[model samples]
Target: MAKKLSSAQLQELAIEKKIKRRNFISFSAFFIGAGAAFGGWKWLYNSPQETAGITAGTRQPLRRALNKTELFFRRIFSNDHVVKTYPKERAAKVVRVNSDIGMSTDNFNAANWQLSVVKKNGHVLKIGIEEIRALPKTEIVYDFKCVEGWDQIQHWAGLRFVDFMAHYGLQEQAEMEYVGMETPDGAYYVGLDMESALHPQTLLAYEMNDQPIAEVHGAPLRLIIPVKYGIKNLKRIGTINFSNQRPRDYWAEQGYDYYSGL
Candidate 1:
């Protein structure tokens, strides 16, 4: 014997099943719509060609936006980002000194060369190569980074920048904002931040690899600031000036970060 439901009961059961199917259909449609929208948005926003066009067309506005972004990140990070250092055994071989913006002239005379250190109150102090050699010398095998996406490790020998400043009684002048160095020919010049200039590894190098600096290597004296890009390390440093205002750098004028430090 078979049992049969009433017509009304059968209609109710059918309605319930129909409602469940409709609900499921609605949910599936909603999910598909959301996925399509997300995909479209990503396609529109994440195109490199579009970004490049925007930057090239609206350079000033884009530059401002970039500056704001950099400032925001820098503030958030608090200057704590440090470059990675390696052991001397892992150091890379010295590469060619790529830039010669300030080294074009050969008019530098080692015998007549003198390094000048200026005081805030307009007093000037001068020292000779012998004076620099008199200070305790330190040698370091460290990496040199370039702003143009390259790096090298080399052996450097010289008096540490802090030691040189200490010998000249410039340690207390911490308020100084810029350290400027010029080649003997006055063609090549650089400006550095006080922090980078006085970094423990920064050196006013007179020698490289246990030998006196070669003429091509900015001999008599050159700055070996490991914390900054190679461009900031001026060779043949004939004049060292401490300034309250930001000093003019050769590369910054040609579009580079003014505070190009590690």
Candidate 2:
């Protein structure tokens, strides 16, 4: 009752067997590769060494990588990517004063308060608030973001840093990559990239909510940079320095990124 197949039929059956075997082999390889990758990720994720990297007074490798990635993206984006602005009615009437690190001294003499500028040419200039007010004023009601994940739209008015530089004849140093600012007592400081510093909205704000800034909120002078987190907005700015080298930062030393951009 059995029937024998021709040589052509036998060849086809052989080819079908080989094809199924090849497909099975490929799928097995893929699953095995995926399993290995998952296992490696789990091991790294739960590793004590990885956790220690962040807590052991060293820059965590992962955190550093993340910071670099953020910086890279910011650099690639246009400097003109402006932060959102709101109408004056939407701005908060009472903006919170977040930190008082450098404001402890009771001897804040507003009458004699002078902002010091360190030029790239090694000349030091002490500028008064009257001189700053002489420049054209820029006002904006913009979202002020803090590192603590809170935001408020506040109105501020001040001279643009670019205009200040131009007025002081320091525009020649615009090519310098970093701007450094510090409190008079050196208790707090911040560093900024030139791109953010030169942004049109960046300001050395002296007025808030259409009035002179209160002493509790960085009276006399403060920096209002919407492009960066509120932490980068140095209060009561005392000294400004222009440098090609990256300057020291308060939060970066405490494990935050120096470029704390929005």
Candidate 3:
């Protein structure tokens, strides 16, 4: 048999039970409020209207966040951080070609192709492919990274972009913050920072794998900027522009990052 509690003791026990119940209720409310906040945040993150602009595709908020993160890193990035190179023996015999936006040259005449450089001062210089080839050639064997989660170790031979700029007396123009390039028909385009453009390994490549670059692989002239992802390497480049402002980028406009660095 249990002894009955005294009145005072019973009162104290009832108070204790009430306090415990209040604590439990408070805890439950806190958790519910926290959960509601988290759920609201998730909904806002996925809200297209809330996060819509230039980067408006699948997962807009995440893409925008990544772009901001990449830009922040690029701001503190080092020019000395070069892409690693491998021995020529490690180069791929045949590199895969993707993105066919600018590859179609059915009516285009390679012989008449000229690389046009537009300076910040509105000065334009039309340079022939032969003139570009006449410049000293720089060769590199490095990993060519693509944004599609694939990469290839390839050998590229071309005139250094810095050398090309110097040859054309555009060193001052090269100091611009951005460099923009596009295909002849304006089918595709890319923008680059001057730092990547001036990297020692970045090239206006005319040869690949110890021979002249085949037509299928950006022949005549193409950008071979190892510092950036392969997409920034505009192939069969027809126009080059230097700008103090951020230039328009094809992939960036399509919900990709403007600074597609390695």
Candidate 4:
């Protein structure tokens, strides 16, 4: 005959059984979740490819998903959703230099830099740096985010894009669907929706950390938009054009999202 167990022994055995059952369920759940993830990844890997914004290719399903995400961000975006600014003390002392595709010119001259702005009337204005500086100056110290999983608090000063439009008599541009900007040599470019482009925090920045922008850091003029990842904060802006069609983006052509909003 089996030995009778005391009350304490019976309770201990019950607890042991309960723990084993719980562990088994937990392990089962983990495997199920992992299997689902693997299936999704495998499906994405085998998906059909399609043309990216420019010429690079991307999975059709992934591209559609990215577009949907872009639309969602666009729907919820508003001028009131401004990025918060911090005190200058919170900004980094040594700003990071990530890409130099546009600023790699050996003979690039900051003083002679001219901004080519395409007006709605089909006229191109070759604007000097002084013209940009003459506009009212606004400064912001905000978290400068990057897509590479890093960020820095930066102090930037420039002419607000909205104010820039009013100054240039280009208020009509705010009504456009998109704004496209590129480096002088056309090595780098980015596109922004009209709302993000005309946001109060967007700027045609000429200074960084209370000084003239470093040449490697986009120099005489660049763009400062806090609401976007660093990829959209174009450097060394050479040409700015208003467009009804979505502009071709350098990164987007490389399989990154066309609308790389924060």
Candidate 5:
């Protein structure tokens, strides 16, 4: 004897089958997507790595990706590109200071602070703060952007980096590929490409918000560069070196973007 199902029973059985089919397809798709992501990560992990002198390797693929990103931004970047400026009234009332790396009393003495510049030809020049102030002054009221995603309007006054280079007769060094700036103790350092280093708004700033720059905010001498995030504006510059090869960057060595353009 065979049993026959009613229309109601047949419809219920069809719905159940469709539900199971849909679930299977959904699970299959989820697993496939997960596997693809894991496979990509694994491939990158197994890629070849090259050794740099002090650092062993950061993996070639990741380094290449960072370099490509830098190149992409640089294609559209230029000194002539003007950064937005604000009225001095909008500047932050209280100076905000961060990263006191080389600003400690043990490392810095404003009395003995003389800029040390090393030329490509191995010549060294010691520059005093007074000499820097004597150069034509430029002031800018602009937003100070930080990598941590906070920004404040800042008022800064100092000499244009280009004029400083010209005043020092550093024409040869200015033409070099890179510039390196370090704190007195060499605790913190940043490398700059020539184009950005010579940006018209880049300044060796000594004043902020209509007053002398405070000790907490790199007093007497610091770089006020509008185009870069605060990190590129090396505080309490101790030494400047010129080279054809890319100079070392503190943040870049730790996997931050070397170019770090806006």
Candidate 6:
């Protein structure tokens, strides 16, 4: 048989148990509420269009809540805007060259390929592949990070982008905020900021993995900017233009970030 507790002791034990139960209930409620709020917010904010009679416009408060939620997530998930490097041992043997914008042209003639560097309202500089090859060649084995969260480390050989720009005497152009490149057929193109175009690892590549660039890999001439996503690293150069206004990018026009860089 158990001894009965005194009234005071019994009251104290009851209070303690009540407090513990209240704490557990409070914690459980907090998490449940949080999850529901997040789900409600997302459903409202991301639904740009209406379903039946329901519309994002009908849930203005929820949408605003979700805007705050996105801001919080952006702060938490925004990785330290730094480029990652790996040793040669860790580098991938076959780095895929994905973009084929300027490559699939009837007149992409690699034998007669020439890079035209255009300045605003001035004479353009036409440079042959040999001229670019004559400049100091640099090899960078770096990770090619895509905006879609994939990366590969590949060896690249080319003239430093800044040096190449300097060689053409277009570096001093203060009005050039954007650089635009297009395939000969103009099917695909990209725009980049001057800062990204001049990153240390950026190159105007003509060779990959110690061999001449393959036809599928922007043979003869290509832009290699490791600091940016693959979309900005245009392949098969046709025309290079410097502009003050923001240039049209093939992807950014389709709701991607214009400055898709590290």
Best by TM-score: 4
lDDT of 3 by residue, 1-262 (tens): 9999999999999999999999999999999999999998887666663254433344656576777887787788776888899999999997888877887877788889888888777878999988888888899999999999999999999999988888888888887788889888788888888888888888999999989888778778999999888889988898999888777778877767778888
Q: What is candidate 5's TM-score against the reference?
A: 0.82
**Which run of 10 residues does model 2 get worst, by summed lDDT?**
49-58
Clashing pairs in model 3? Answer: none
Tens digits of per-residue lDDT, candidate 5, 51-80, equal: 563222577788888788877876777767
Stretches off by above 4 angstroms in model 1 are: 1-94, 104-106
Query: What tens-digit string does per-residue lDDT give for candidate 6 at 103-157?
Result: 6657557898888777787778788989889999998788888887887888779
lDDT by candidate, in order shown: 0.73, 0.84, 0.85, 0.89, 0.85, 0.74
**Number of the top-ranking candidate, with lDDT as the measure:** 4
Worst 10 residues of 1 by lDDT: 49-58
Model 6 bad stretches (over 4 Å): 1-84
Worst 10 residues of 5 by lDDT: 49-58
TM-score per prediction, in order, is 0.68, 0.78, 0.79, 0.96, 0.82, 0.73
The residue-level lDDT of candidate 1 at 151 comes to: 78
Superior candidate under TM-score, 5 versus 6: 5
Output the TM-score of candidate 6: 0.73
lDDT digits (tens) for residues 138-161 of candidate 2: 999998999998988899999999
Error of 1 at 179 (Å): 1.4
Model 3 CA deviation exceeding 4 Å by range: 1-45, 49-60
Provide backbone clash counts, one per model. Answer: 1, 0, 0, 0, 0, 1
State the displacement of the C-alpha of residue 162, model 5, in Å, after optimal TM-score superposition: 0.6
